[model samples]
Target: KILSYLDDSGSGRVDLGMFYAVVAPLCGGHLDKRKRVAFEALLWRPVNEGGSSQITKMDAVKYIKLLRAIYIPSQGMSEMLEVHGEADDDTSSSMVTFNQFLGMYDDSEWGFGIMSTVVKLETRDRNRHGNQVCSVCRYPIIGSRFKEVKTGFSLCNQCYSEGKVPPTFKQQEEYKFREYGSEVEAMKAKCVCFSMQSHKNPIAT
Candidate 1:
């Protein structure tokens, strides 16, 4: 469609204003600025006629980027951003898209990488013992050290059992905790598995 706008005349390629008019209707007033620019440039440029005033793909790309910079960002885009959470442009999204010309679309499903930090309040035992230290091994009674909890006196697994090794090391690559008491699951997984006191109950993770 953009190719149709290219003016093959010797005057040179038309500006984004010309392209904007060309794409206004096609975009239905919601045209992603860059695409709108490309459609116009491709349509008005005379390059295809005889390569006489040919504009390279790079030329169209430059204009589209410019439009993106100037285009009034929609509140809808911001709302979508809030709902979807902040992410990198490369991340998958339902409302974000990028074009071959490097133009970004609000409706693109791509997302960006956005690292975040979270703080959590955690206790050690299923019993809700906020201050209880294990009787035997004195393992730290915290959500972070669940696996070390033992039957006899909340002793360290090493002290509680006959041997410090697992029943069978053959199945998995043997891993060890610094000190046993309770296990903390991945934060994301814990959101569902472990319950919060007010929200649910921060029981055994």
Candidate 2:
């Protein structure tokens, strides 16, 4: 059944809230990118899916306000996860390639991991909010256009000079050993891994 377009009843236009709750029902995934697209299509940005109305930034903010109706504080509300908890215990006896663990954000070039084992957050500022070291290149990745990505275990940068890209976010750069986040440089970085072997205290600073 189709969701009623009631949410689309914008005060003067179809803001983000109405777009996500109403029209987005016709699409998949969360209401995030979809809402952005709708905003762009309607009035902010252009859309190829056939939309051109234009919207304002204030409108986007207002719609985001409506979303509070369905808000939940927990990112881990899964009953199964609550009951069984995380697999802190190593269950897998075998190892798998990085591709099996992460989603590929881009697919045009060679495997991002094969070329570089590290991928940084890639920012213009020198303040390393956080940086990653790929095993393939063994270089610290930190540029806007850099093909920075992460596998569950490590990050990967692209061998830009050679022109190879990792197939998935879980890859290493071309010429270095894929290393985990550099603890010294990322002085404030916190590990998110849950496996006991990976870290003594997953919540450690």
Q: Which stretches of candidate 2 lie over 4 Å from their true place?
A: 1-38, 41-52, 55-62, 66-132, 137-182, 185-205
* Clashes per model (N, Cα, C within 3 A): 43, 36
Best by lDDT: 1
Q: Which regions in candidate 1 have their CA more than 4 angstroms from the true location?
A: 1-18, 21-41, 51-55, 72-205
Q: How much is the lDDT of residue 154 in candidate 2? A: 36
State the lDDT of candidate 1 residue by residue for 80-193, as single tens digits. 223323344433222212243333222244311010100112111443434445444565454433332222223343443433433433254543333432333333334554
lDDT of 1 at 74: 35
Error in Å for residue 100 of model 2: 44
Residues forming the 10-long window of minimal summed lDDT in candidate 1: 111-120
